[model samples]
Target chain A: MTGVATLIRQPWLWAWVGALVVWLATAVFTGGKGSGEVLSAAMTFGAFFVIVALGQMFVITLGPGNVDLSIPACMTLAGTVAMKSMDGASAMIPVGLLLALVIGAGVGTLNYSLIRLLRIPPIIATLSSSFIFQSAAIWWNRGLRVKPPEALADFTTAKIAGVPVIALFVVVLAILGHVLLTRTIYGRGVVAIGQNMRAAHLAGVKVERIRAATYIMCATLAGLCGYLLAAFSGGAALNMGEEYLLSSIAVVVIGGTSVAGGFANVPGLWGASLFLFLLVTMLNTFGAGAGVRLVLTGLIIIGVIVAASGGKART
Target chain B: MSGRLSPRLLRSLLPPLSLAALLIAIFWLQPRTMSYFGLNLLLNLAIPIALATIAQMFILCVNELDLSIGGFVSLVACITATWLHDTPLLGIAALAGLIAAYAALGALIHLRNLPSIVVTLGMSFVWLGLAVLVLPTPGGNAPEYIRTLMTLKPAYIPFPIIASVVIALVVHVGLMRSAHGTVLRGAGGNPRSLECAGWSLLKIKMGMFALAGFFGVLSGMALVGLTTSADANIALRYTLLSIAGVILGGGEFVGGRVSPIGAVIGAITLALAGSFLSFLRLNPDWQIGAQGAILIIVLALRVLIGRAEARK
Candidate 1:
């Protein structure tokens, strides 16, 4: 009983429980033609969003002025490069994936360099990088969009006994990320940096390198998510990455990760992602348009921040 | 301490001057395309954004952001177009009404102690929804008089540019020479300290927000004059661009100092930059990238100069 009570004291655990109840309630109310298809879509979207959100979570939880506005733009650039490079050849998938990872790391490094060397605040630096990446994507495509290869598309759409392959991919990435964040010295450094950068600096945490690595990790995951999303949709567009920016941030905050930094909850992020996806789906089913969704997302984010900040003050 | 102006202040003046130099260079280089008429065109373009930047500076000075200004502009424009269509007098009345409504919303958000970012963002949605609810498609035309006022050059100089200068001067005076301005700056620099000093933080914030809303309405009015029609997405970029302009003008997030004149100059610089890019027939994407890069550079320079001076 004492152990259970202790577990209940975890903020992320409570958040997960709340998110689960919301998701289940939403799923029950939105009865559809095929439960299997709905489940698969939900799982796929939820998983991918969580991965992207976790990338943001790392930056937000460890850095000052915590946030990255460039995640979506970076992802779009990665997907664009991957698709164009592969050019519908199954044999080139490995090359395409490697290119995507390289692009991600390159973007991360650029942002890190700009923020550290130029002393630009992270938000402004990332925002500028996002714009640069967006422009580059537009310039490279020259207004032309290429479709992904059939095999690569299959990687996203192919189901295992009615479960989405993308879901499995997201799960594997999440597990890897979870381990990396919990079991490694670098992961501990990230947590320490988040708790107190000055203290971590004193303890020999190579603050600059750790910050750069965090950005690289974030960009890589965002790139992977973009790649999968492009494959799932069969093609990409200039504005394709815009929607994910808010959703990614929203999931991270809703997952009980303090925007002010310190502590991470992987399970909580997953639950929040699931809840958000379900909520979006429900809103869509109810005939809500893009404007409504944007408003609701903005409100929820603001509400969460205000409530959390208020709670801290009260304590 | 001596009251002599610091070197940081001197360094801070560099961006606006450089931007002015750049604009002049562009004007000189493209004399054939950017003649006196082109200067007027540039002025007309700068007006809405300049006004929007002033509004953005108000919030930014208070260490907050207003992402809903675009939505507010759109809402104001749409309302003016629909209610004042074909009737110049009615359009003026409609513009005033909409501005009042938006100003109230800003005040209410401040009263609630809400973060301006989320509040304005939500309000932007509300504005969009209202726009869509009123006009599903973009069809309403602004009154001919208003359109003329927006587009017509006043004796070889654009009226909008002149209006922007006038507005900038007014805001400069209001902020620098008034007791209200001091309190607003105090609230922005350190709200807790101001409150401890027995000032009402909420009142100062509300006043600042109202001023921002008023500026947003002015931008909308200018926009209506320029486009001759109201579109929902017309002001979308202005939200962030205005913030970028303020920062580029050397306005810090935490208040105590603001340069309305600098912001106006920044607005002009940005307007010319966009015009130059378009003139070169460069991709719009490049313009976006350049704007972001320039803003980042300016911000970095501002921070570095400030830090260096502090060390000295």
Candidate 2:
């Protein structure tokens, strides 16, 4: 009983509760019809969100004022470049994937240089860089949508035992992410820097190197997500990554990660991602208009953030 | 001490210097822009941008960012073009309500210690939703009075210049010179001190948010007046533009340091950057990239100057 009580108090538990509650709400609303379908759909889409949010979580965990506003543009550029490189050729998939990762690394390097060398704030640096990336995407393909290769698309959309393959892959990835956050020196360094940069540096945490690695890791994951998302959706559009910007941040905050930095919640990422998808799915199922749906999303997000952050008192 | 003061002075001078340089380059490239008519053509759209920058500056002074400013401006524009044009009283009430809502949001954020970015991100959705609900298709008439006011040509100078000058002076006087403004800014610079000094942080935050809302309304109304119409997504870009404008004008993200006059100038400089690109005949596809490059170059210049300062 005590163990269960402690589990209930964990910050990550609320997101799971919220996800389950919304899922049940949707199930109840439809008289249990299509509930399985809704859950499957949530799993499929939620995987993409979890991928990006994972990167974002690491970035946010580094400290306040540290966020990657360029995720959307990076995704667009990567997806566009990768799709164009593959060009419906299964044989060129590895080359395209490598190219996407390279683009992500380059973007991350530029973003970090702007922050470190130019001494610009991270928010402004990433935001400005996004414009360049977005324009690059536009200039490269002129906003054209290119279809993914046959085998890649099939693998992305394929399911095993009613579970999406991508979702399963991401679940294993999340387990690895959990181990990386809690059981690694670099992870501890990130948390240390977030808690107190000066102390972290004094303790020989290699603050700059750790920060650099975290950012590069984040962008690399964003790259992989873009590649898979393009494949899953059958094509890559210019505006494909636009909605992920908000959703990525929303998932992090809603998952009960401390916005102030120094803390992380890996399990909560999955729950929050599913909850967000289901919330939208619930609204859509009820035949709510766009305006109403958006308003409710805003209000509900506010509610969740409030509830999640309620326990901790900050001066 | 004198050497340190020189660097501070130099930092203060960068915004105006850059604006002048850009202006001179544009005039030299397109000599016709030197005339009053050409100047109006170049700067007419800058009025709303300057207002939005000022709104952003107000929030920056309180050490908060308003990601919803773009959406808020879009909603205001929709209301101005639709209700304000057709039903004047109803429009006034709606605008007032929006400003009140902004103040309420500030109180909620301050009391709960919620991250402003998340709250405002959510509010951005709400504002966009409301704007879409109000103007589904983006066709509305600007109020007759607003249209006339926007287009009024004064003697000896263009209206945009006059309006921008008045705006800068008014905000400068209100926020930079007034005693109350100091207290408001102090809330951001050192809230604990202000709390110890027995000032209500909540009221200060509310005032700042309300001021931001007021300027956002002006930006939206001015934009609609100039364009003679409104759309749900009309000012979606203003959020970023305003932040860039504030930074260009030497506003720091966390500090309470901000310059109203410089912010307006920075806004004009950015607006002129678009014109400069067109004059240069840059490819339309690369214009956005060029804008980003310009932002990076300017900030890089700031860093170079700082390095010099540090060496000294």
Candidate 3:
């Protein structure tokens, strides 16, 4: 009971509660008619962001000044390659997906190699890679758009029982992510490493491998999100993945993952994602443009970080 | 002392030397491109980015990032372009006002001792929104005089490039020689130590942020001249690119070490790299790969060299 009480008082738990309230309010305010469509869009967007956020959470939790700026770029490259190859063939959907996964893995490996081999700070290396990836996407498209197959697009656009299929996909991904973080040995090692790298290393955690894997996982998830985005949008654009960069970081941070790494609150992230979605929906409902959205997102992220830091200091 | 050069000096010199080498390579490959006219254009291109890099260097030296320069530039450019379309002096005034506004905002965040990155990020959004509200479709244009002044060359040198050189020199001297510079360095190097010494960390941080804001304005103003118009997303790449340049120049995140000359050189190197890519006619995507590769290489070199020095 005491443990439960302590957990309840955790910052992440509180954030989750806040998120719930925001979500409920959003649902209530947007009631009837296109409310369902708006909610589905929000869910799909939130889920996609969640995948990227989770990967970031893994890096942040370990806290070795770890950050991956290349995630979006990796996603962009993956989606571009996948869609470019698929070219609207229903049969090629699986192939495209597989290719995206492979590209993700390749990017992950490349990022890992740069970090481990070159010993560049993760942030700089990742940022540079991101630029490279964006350039690659631009180069691949050559100022043209790459549309995914109709079947894939149909899947992306499909709604079952008034819920977006992509939302379901996100939920499943989130559950899998939660399980991987909590139940697996690899997951435990990740947490252990995040808590204290030296201690984890001494305990045979294969710190480098784990770190590399985390990058890989992050890139892979981002890649998957990109595929879904491409399918939903019916094509891939150069800037498609760029917007998610900060939001992913924001979600993870708001979800109660410390910038320096340690414990991550999956539930908190879920709530935060929902909250963010609602917040954006509300802003859009108010008829704000992309510029407004960008500004709000940036402000909310800063606010959340400051609030969290203050809360921690108070505790 | 006669026989040995200091490692600090050597490290400080490396980026500039590399930058020179890169420029020479460009010159060798395309003499026409590196000609007086070409050099002038290149220099003009470097000003806004160089100023933005200096701003980013200030934040980074304190181990923080500023992802809001894009928004800052946009807002400043938008306001300058919109409100001062007919009057060049008003454009300059509006530019100054925007800088002051951003500086005040930056100072507020620093006083709160909050992470500069997060604060700047949010402020960027606010500014961007304001920019859109002011000019939604990039309709406004700069005064003809401002545009001509920006584009016109003096003798052999372009005005923008000359402006960049002047600003760089001023900043270099200010950062290296001033008492405030010392305090700023101390705060960045070890805030706790400075605080223990009874220095106001917040004050130092706020001052540094103000300096960053000033540079942001300079960059934005230069950009307005170059483009002759303001788009909300014009300076988006500068946010990260400036940081990259600062890091590549071998500046420490904490303020004790900075090389304005190196940063300019670093900017030049980047510009040269882009030019080289264009010259090669490689898929522009290769440029991205190259930047990433360079970052990885520079970081690796830094770590390896640092570790070697530590061992010694």
Cα-based lDDT for every prediction: 0.74, 0.89, 0.75
Better of 2 and 3 by lDDT: 2
Please give fnat for model 1.
Answer: 0.32
Q: Which digits, one per residue and each the tens of the lDDT, describe model 2 over residues A263-313? A: 998999999999999999999999988888888888888888877667344
- The C-alpha stretches of model 2 lying farther than 4 A from their native spots are A311-313, B1-5
Model 3 ranges off by over 4 Å: A1-8, A13-33, A202-204, A289-294, A311-315, B1-9, B86-113, B143-149, B156-161, B254-256, B300-311
Q: List-wise, what DockQ does each model earn?
A: 0.38, 0.67, 0.51
Instruction: Considering only chain B, report the TM-score of each candidate against the true chain B.
Output: 0.87, 0.97, 0.88
How far off is model 2, as Cα RMSD?
1.7
Docking class of 1: acceptable
CA shift of B276, model 2, Å: 2.1
Q: What shift in Å separates residue B36 of candidate 3 from its native position after superposition? A: 2.0
Regions of candidate 1 where Cα sits further than 4 Å from its true position:
A1-9, A13-36, A289-315, B1-6, B83-127, B255-257, B281-285, B297-311
Query: Looking at model 3 chain A, which ten-residue stretch has the lowest summed lDDT?
Result: A306-315
Estimate the TM-score of every prediction.
Answer: 0.89, 0.97, 0.91
lDDT of 2 at A204: 94
Worst 10 residues of 2 chain A by lDDT: A306-315
What ranking of all candidate models by lDDT puts the best one first? 2, 3, 1
> Of the true interface contacts, what fraction does each candidate have?
0.32, 0.55, 0.62
Q: What is the C-alpha RMSD of each candidate to the true structure, in Å?
A: 3.6, 1.7, 3.0
